[model samples]
Target: MVNAPAEQKKLPSWWSGGSVVYQIYPASFKDDDGDGYGDLRGIINKLGHIKSLGVDAIWICPHYKSPRVDEGYDISDTDIHEPFGTREDCQELIDAVHAHGMKIMFDLVVNHCSDQHAWFKESRSSKTNPKRDWFYWKPPRMIDGVRHPPNNWRSCFGGSVWEWDEHTQEYYLHYFCSEQPDLNWENPETRQAIYNDAIRYWLDRGVDGFRIDTVNMYSKYLDFPDAKVVAPETPWQPAGDFFSNGPRLQEFLREMRKEAFSKYDCFTIGELPNTPSLEKILSYISTDAEALDCTILFDLADLDHRGGQYPLMGRNWALSQFKALTAFAQQLAEPEHKAHALTYLENHDQARSVTRYASDAPEHRLTSSKLLATYLLTLSGSVIIYEGQEIGMINAPKDWDIDTEYLDVNTINTWREIKHDAKVQNDPSLLERGRAGIQLTARDHARTPMQWDGSKNAGFSSNPDAKPWYRVMESYAEGLNVGAQEDDPNSTLNFYRQLVSLRKAHKDLFILGRFQLLDPGNDQTMLFTKTALDGSQVAFVALNFSAEKQPFELPIELTARQSQLLISTLGKSSESRELDAYEARVYLA
Candidate 1:
């Protein structure tokens, strides 16, 4: 165990309060040396911008040494931050964030590793190898003189999960991509090695915590039963329920907690998809539980469909959908031993929220942005804001393509499969274009180089000719740069500044308060209030579904002489008691 320095005295209250955590997608954040990708030095340069947002922590996406199969998620080394910069650069980032009074949370992708990783390479070389059992390798069945996969499980990118290894004469299951071989957590040695090495590597580097990728899938059923085939031939996988949250999960977590996380006041949030049952989440992050500190449930993100419910396609989002998502969050927050849920509108894997909600109009886009901010910040859990969310960045324009070359292996493979499918043959050009139009919609949209100025390359890189690995939105060249936004008070950047400041100042009501639903029966709109223990009642909310102004009355009988409008997306709340289209308001009642 790494010993803590004697000078350290206390830990920050990141868990029990509303702490603003900024997520940085390193590759597209900014390029310092013009390497065509973002680096640690670039992040250090942007510390002032992060601080200006009044956030308390920053979640740096994977920088670990890897083959970059799945961005940096397919990590080969747990101890170092690779091509992005040196180990010292990572330490420098942690130190810089600390200097700004903010914490740093690194991405930890322990569920799998790139096929090129030393461990996977060794495990696949021979059946008798010492590391042979390190990964989920199975003997191929002899069928009609040909080898067949042990089961019919599909991968996340779509298609069979098993990959035939000619060298080992066996098949290995990869839940994500063929390149990302899933680790066998059934092995004690493998689990211990990852825990000891990864936790020590970052803890020693002084990182505040980690955001775990697919934490629930670490443990699998010993039987390895084939999941119910949702799509047998086409390659679409289900939630992996039979293989997730296995018997050994808690055991493995307690070991990790005992060996590493418990030593320091660290925070860990798991990425558990389709984990709808509250019991499953509670066991993982309850204060007295055996595992992590929190988790990012897929409920809200999955609820985003296009059929006026939640649309994953690059179609416009409905205000009703936004309201429904927040209502779900409000319910999750009420669990007595609720595992802190990370509420978000967009992330590196999803499409941009602005484009998902607002059509091609900037006015509606900005209004929807505020509406989301109001709903997100009002929740009682940790809030993770994606890189470009602050300025209301939208999805990539339909004309923009070229995402496959920049996407990770699994993402590219999935796009190719979708393109090849006859079902979507109507838009054959989309496949030739790499589904750069939709499959990679959200991330690529958010990954556009941080708009720094109307400079040559949005001021993200020094060379205008250098390919940025991802296309930059054309707006940067038109005056959407950071410099321009800094001067314009009306810019999306300033509005975010005000939004964050309001969240920080009202911590008691927002962070430590109880969330109560105001219009519980209304599916068309979401309205809620936060009542602090100290009797400071703050009515927090948003109106997203319909274009018409929605009328709402207070749930409680309040005799206050006047309601003070703290913040409103629509003009003054006092003047307009009725909500305008996509309007959000905060009031002191």
Candidate 2:
């Protein structure tokens, strides 16, 4: 490991702390080549729209050379995918983003590589191969004259994590799909190669930073043990305790920071899964140590999750739960803690926030959308907005037939699992519940092509007859398209723009201020304040999560201060403190 001094490490700048990032799923963003796929050229063609949204940076999903068994997550090589673009196209896109005065963050998937990768091929060639130790490979357990997997660990996709390789007569471990084999971080050569060859190569190309995928899974327990059965109904329990935040994870991350990140002026945001405790997350991103700049924890997003058998399960989240989660998240931004939290409502892996957390009714959608935006933008930590979220995009119709309609690989796999279980149990209601669960929880709801206009393919592709990789939403042409709402003064899209503008204007209060939860016991309404360190400026954000109008009273302490309305969903200032249905307001003092 490269031992760099802590003093030499580059710290995050003011812009990094305050910036809003926009996430782009390259496959579903735009199809500039009209080949039914989004490419680098397509992203370059749409930079103007991103600029108009006022985000400081854009985090592009994986575009590495891959067989696409799990979309772009299974990376086969360290080069650009031909379908997405060539290396030249990638360079041009990066330059264009810099020219537009915006930074670009690439998705970095280092926990594993595609089984088709050259390194994996060499490692699996023979037990005596020089690279044989680069991956986790072991002989299968011979029980009762039968060959079985080494352990009870199950893959995230399904089935056993250990896949038997007939060629070598050994079982190779894969936490995700069989096509994607987990890398052995314990091997110094392997970790060094990933850092020097892959990571440094990208940084040298003028890329800003990376959104590290499954970063907390880099280290694993030395002993391959059977995971405890947390959910008895399922065949295997999640092996998060053994793999998610391993004992050596922090050491490995610090080494990565010292070897690569400390030398450059870039930020690192790690995706931490299965971390229910804030203390565990803080250890990975605390600024006091040589670790990541920020981390995304799923505690808030998993509030409504049910059915431990499957990873993705959902129900209508309660207003009280939402308030509690938000309040707990805000507490992480206290002045004493060095780490920063990454706040977000939706992403490529999640369903649309409007349909999941807000009302889907036609009259209430806009107001609820605006209310969510107000709460998100006024938070103390940096925020990320998923594509299409600014325009109040909802999930696909509940009646969509998964077998016939376009669905992402994640959704299709989960649907099959749920269907098989339901059939085995001989219960038809289970199947019905599974279908409804997919409608509310499937990740494909966010993977649909961007609704740009009412033209062919939702204006995402130039060809009039080209079918997109995923089916476009039916409501795109009806009214949900960007062209339909871009110019409307009261549209959800405009409300997002206004919120972003307001956040940027009050960076000191929203970005660098101290967060305090006010009236924390209230379930239907959430009120918070961000005050400057010196108490010279203050900003208060009030959100009504209920469908019915609610009465609110400003705190007596704030009543003496002059209040200036910054932005409000109701479009009018009320002296009586009566908030309209799903209304949100920001007041500056």
Candidate 3:
């Protein structure tokens, strides 16, 4: 397998490609300094807790200096955010992560920079400035009698990607919010600068590796073509195809690897979205590739959504489609591909899987969460566990005021847009739909403060009176926090811990064995078997994706083999049903 570099090969099992990763949204994790926000010191304090989960590495979302317009993805500088901590605090976190026998991955945002960044400031200061070509700046086109953006490209957040610069009398492009401008990768100086400052700087600081943000979006065509009109009512259109995986993508990646990553013993997981071709996705992680070791895809994450995270567009996803996309990713483990992938049901950008993928009703919450965990941990690839997911956290109540409580930029934008549309159309259904779907695709659902205990502020903030950046889920007081699950043997938290151990105990079969997806036509249960390459053993896995009981028989390939139960979400099922609601079982033969 293209798992590790020569030096990394000598390290522990977790250092390999199959290592489990725990992702922490630092702003909502814990407020150790009592500043009403989570900081590096808080992560340092929780190293033991994360280590307890048997994770090989921790990927803390961007704590970089920013205006917080897009939650630190818009970087003003490469330095650590003051609210989060200092450069010394970052170093301390790296030391602490290593001391706890785990690696740390930084979020690298090379696609864009905050408008206030010195580079952007210099670039936009004057048309003749030396750094003027470092970012995308275009002259507005005349539309009838009014000036309009150069193209119909829409910002990922909302509205036009080209923002008017009254001072410069030109428009600069931002793939996200207007404050975050896309960098020009065509310029060698820009590429070299990022390589020197962002890439090598962290590697020089003893950090393990990185989770490169939007890795495929680094390059773009300079011609600046107009996008197809998908939604005529909207001022801008979805122009992802025009900017993603551009011609120079591979060349730039190879250059970055040669100039930085190849020089260090590190690991990298790229955040690659809007990429649908499995062949293109595999190329990056292929055994012969010269770039990243692994990549995270959004193919399965947006299955239930209609227009890529739009409000009130949630739709029921077919189990067959989910299985096919899932199996497509598993192809990385094939001998021909010889690559690796990371599996997860939740991340920093989506609502909790307990509510989105499975029933969050009191009756099914625990088993359903465990069911997802079983599916995640039993795969042949590395696993990623988001914060609070281990305890079966669900979405916040929809009645919360969007203006005051839902403070996320995307959430605020969506709320305002839908609210205006509702009023203009003289139909209250739009606003109602937005509220009804708040738990469906709102980014704020994923940004809620972590629930550590049942105490004040859910033990996230030491001060009982401090109002944290986001509202803490009130359910924490009802035995949904880690403190309550820490000692409960049957809790979802403990169940995840057990599954982690189970995966490690059979790493050979779980990580390197062949992934045989069985019963592809079944609409309720996900049934599969991992067969050791040597044909000496096989582990059969069955996962119920519904709240109702399901009956299933093992495929003939595994039916006659005597097997021992390795793990099950519903422990020692007493029900007459063969597979209890949301039950998952793994048996090794």
Top candidate on lDDT is 3
Identify the runs in model 3 with alpha carbons over 4 angstroms from their true place.
1-14, 306-312, 573-577
- Report lDDT (CA) for all predictions: 0.70, 0.83, 0.83
Q: If the candidates were sorted by their lDDT against the true structure, best first, what order would they fall in? A: 3, 2, 1
| Error in Å for residue 240 of model 1 | 2.9
Candidate 1's TM-score reads: 0.90
Q: How far is 530's C-alpha from truth in model 3 (Å)?
A: 1.4
Q: What would you estimate as the lDDT of candidate 1?
A: 0.70
The TM-scores of all predictions, comma-separated, are 0.90, 0.95, 0.95
- Cα RMSD, each candidate: 3.6, 2.7, 2.8
Clashes of each: 14, 0, 0
Please give the lDDT score at residue 74 for candidate 3. 89
Per-residue lDDT tens digits for candidate 2, residues 305-413, read 6436666656566677777777677766766877786799999888888777777788888898898888888888789999898888888987778887845666677
Cα distance off (Å), candidate 3, residue 88? 1.4
**Residue-level lDDT tens digits of model 1 in 414-458:** 555655653555766544444433533535566677877777778
Candidate 3 local Cα displacement, residue 572, angstroms: 1.3
* True-structure Cα RMSD, model 3: 2.8
Report the Cα lDDT for residue 277, model 3: 86
Winner by lDDT between candidate 2 and candidate 1:
2
lDDT of candidate 3?
0.83
What value does the lDDT take at residue 349 in candidate 2?
81
